[model samples]
Target: MMQTVQKRRTAGFLLVISGASLWGIGGTVSQYIFEIHHLPVEWLVAVRLLLSGLLLLTISLMLGNKEKVTGIWKQKKSAGAVVIFGLFGMLAVQYTYMASIESGNAAVATLLQYLAPVFILAYLLAVRHTYWNMRDAGAVLMGLAGTFLLLTNGELAGLSVPTEAVVWGLLSGVALAFYTLYAGPLLAAWGSMNVIGWAMTVGGAAVSFLHAPWNAAWGSWTWSMAGSVIFVVIFGTMIAFWFYLESLKYLKPQETSILGCLEPLAAILASVWWLHVPFGLYQSVGTCLILGMVIYLSLPQKQRAKPAPA
Candidate 1:
């Protein structure tokens, strides 16, 4: 039994790492699709959400989870929660992330999104009146300091990237926090696949109505574009979510969140290697500070205080 538990923990760690890496590299792949293929951002987002959602739902059905998928909507509260999550949390995260990547490269966009933890910590302290912990405080300071270095790069003259990218990136972080907070109860009630699948489907359908996927010019589609899209849909969105959620069975959410730091590292590496995006000295140090803080927060606290009851 002890050995089995150890194996499960190991599997969970591997799963989370693999999932985060896929998402990180997937962002780079998305950058290629946008820059090289010049695919419309709206169209790509719509199709990706829809296709990934359907694929997840199909997988759940194969695993004899069709009842969970179909039954989620039968309850009024669950259905309403799904709609809100779909329209607000899911749509917000997707749109803001794509918009950030559109204005900047994937590396900056992803790192900015990681700032969600800081935002979440702040909200918990200020709004929720949660007790302040020194570790979380340190994490917030490090995250902010790192973000400052990354954006300004010690240049007092002007911002590194366009102001537009910064705005979208910040918004992406906030939306991610919202997504994490909003999805908790739903995930408990209906499992990750069911919640995510329905949310993605609803969000994607809403975007599709506006973007009109059919209107996208098919002449632009090439082998490279096809490959990128397939990878993003399958490996990036579907498999990544699957592994990350599956890891929850063995690892605590906090551990998984810490392991997620691998995402920014993977994104930065992909940006540097594949896209040849420039990385400066100060920016590297800044990223290290942020990652270190993340690791710090990930460490087990001997007597961590319990969160206040909602």
Candidate 2:
């Protein structure tokens, strides 16, 4: 019994780490696609969401979740929730992230999106769903301090990256926070794949209507570019989510989130090595502060608290 439990825990850690790493490197692959192929953000986002969603739904159906795959839309409340999540949460997160990358490099974009925790804390505080606490304050401070360093490098005279990138990146973080918070109940009720599959399909379909997949003018795909796109859709979006969610069976959500820090770390490394993006000392410190504060905030609070493990 003890050995089996240990193996499950180990498997969980590996799954989360693998999922996160795939997501991290996926950003770098996207950066390459944008730089080399000049793929439009709208086209890429549309293709990714739609294809990944379909693949997930296909898997769910094969796994005997056919009922769930079709049943989620039978009720108005559930269907409505899926629509909201798909449009505002999933679509926003996906679109803003790609936009951020287009405006800036992958490293900054990934780090900024990591600020979702701070946004979630603020939202909870605003609604009185959670009270103010030192830990929350620390998270906010760390996020602010980190953003300053990452963008300004402590000069404060002007941003190191384009102003537009910052705006998109911040929006990405907000959307991520909303996605994380809004999907909890639905995911619990409908199962992760079933709910997210439909959400992705809905978000994809909405975007498809605006920027139809058949109409995509994403640059001519070379062999390498094709491989990269495939990796982004298959490993990054679909399998990454699967592994991350699957880890939940063995590891606490908090533990998975903490381990999920590997995503940004992987992105940063890939950005620096693969893309030749600069990562100076101050920016490095900022990244640490941001990621550390995130990990800290993920910790179970000393006092009783609402939301998360705390």
Measured by TM-score, the strongest candidate is 2
Runs of candidate 2 with Cα error greater than 4 angstroms are 217-219, 303-310
Candidate 2 lDDT over 180-244, as tens digits, reads 99999999889999988888888888888767777755465578888988999999889998899
What 10-residue stretch in candidate 2 is worst by lDDT? 301-310
TM-score of 1: 0.94
Q: lDDT of each model, Cα atoms only?
A: 0.87, 0.90
Which pairs clash in the backbone of model 2? none
Q: Best-fitting candidate, measured by lDDT?
A: 2
Query: Stretches of candidate 1 above 4 Å error?
Result: 302-310
lDDT of 2 at 225: 81
TM-score of 2: 0.96
